[model samples]
Target: MRPRGIFWPGVAGIASGALMLVALVVTYGNSPDYEGRNGLRETVEFYRDAGNRDLTEAMALVMLAAGLLFLFFLAALARVTASRSSLVLVGGILFVALTMIATIAGAIYAITASHTEAFVVTPGTGTVALLLLDVSYAGTVAAMVGAAVLLFAVWRASRTTGAVPQWLAWFGFVIAVLCLAGPFSAWLTVLLMALWTVLAGVVLVLRPPTEA
Candidate 1:
């Protein structure tokens, strides 16, 4: 088999992850003290600074698109893996759902962050916005769990069906473990996930399914 449906999903995953990474780097740069610093008041100030609002909104939009693309990629992955094992399919589905929640929460936070004036004046609104942002972090835990499960599923499938290379499955396991380190390791997590996704996509595109 040529892995007919894998090409588009791989492309989508690569594009989605790359776009989000670029957006984050461009918007935040080297500044660790950008948005969500000090407290709700500081966060409001960060966004209220005029120049930051446009960038914040733009970044949010990019992330939103990335999230949508990731969903599509996950759906395709689910389809591809469905015949190998039901557990693997479920893992992909769970990953998709959890990621969607995280993405939506992040977008909401970005929207709220952009509206600096509204949150600045309305005391509690900033807190609410900050809370929403935190919700995304919470969602990441679930997403990581899903990623781990999916990786495990892939590992198991690879062992029997040769659906993916053993090394790729192992790499996924490593990435999944790194992802569990939480917000402190977020940068590493994102980089590893993006690399894995791109590599997986490329492999699926270049190799015949039967070859694996």
Candidate 2:
């Protein structure tokens, strides 16, 4: 497999990941801190305010876009690893499903955030929104786990088939270990995975195809 056809998918993956990271930072950085149990009201206010609505929308849209692009990246990865190991293929597919779930959850939260006025007006709506946010975060955690599994499988495949360098395999193992640390480390795991994805894409583009 030449990987020539999949090159654009790699590029799209990197671009989307970059955009998602930037949009996420911009969305959260400018917003007020909404941590702790007492922070729900503040979160409601932040979303309700007209000035912050645009950032909320951007975050939502970018997440959705990133999710779509991530699918492309996963497909390319699965194709690359298919000949190397069945475990890698399965892990890639699982990761794709979990990531899609996370993306949908994120989109739902965005929709909820966009309609803060309605949530505020209707009793219990805010609670529901918060619950949705929790679910979205949970989905993110699960997706990260799926990514960890994929990376681990990739590492195993690399060891057997030499599809990727040993150092890269070790790097994947380290990231996978971090990802398995659960929700508290999710953000850091995500950032690391995003960087890894970009680097992997670049490496795929540059490396010559191996003979089957």
Highest TM-score: give the candidate number.
2
Decoy 1 TM-score against native: 0.76
How many angstroms is residue 200 displaced in model 2 relative to the true structure, after the best TM-score fit? 0.9
What lDDT score is found at residue 136 in candidate 2?
Answer: 64
User: Residue 74 error for model 1, in Å?
Assistant: 2.9
Q: What ranges in model 1 sit over 4 Å off?
A: 23-37, 79-85, 109-124, 180-187, 209-212
Prediction-by-prediction clash tally:
0, 0
CA deviation > 4 Å runs, candidate 2: 1-4, 27-32, 83-85, 107-124, 209-212
The whole-model C-alpha lDDT of candidate 1 against the native structure comes to: 0.64
Model 2 Cα lDDT, one tens digit per residue, 151-175: 8988887777776668878888898
**lDDT at 156, model 1:** 68
Roughly what TM-score does model 2 have, to 2 decimal places? 0.82
Q: Report the error of model 2 at residue 60, Å.
A: 2.0
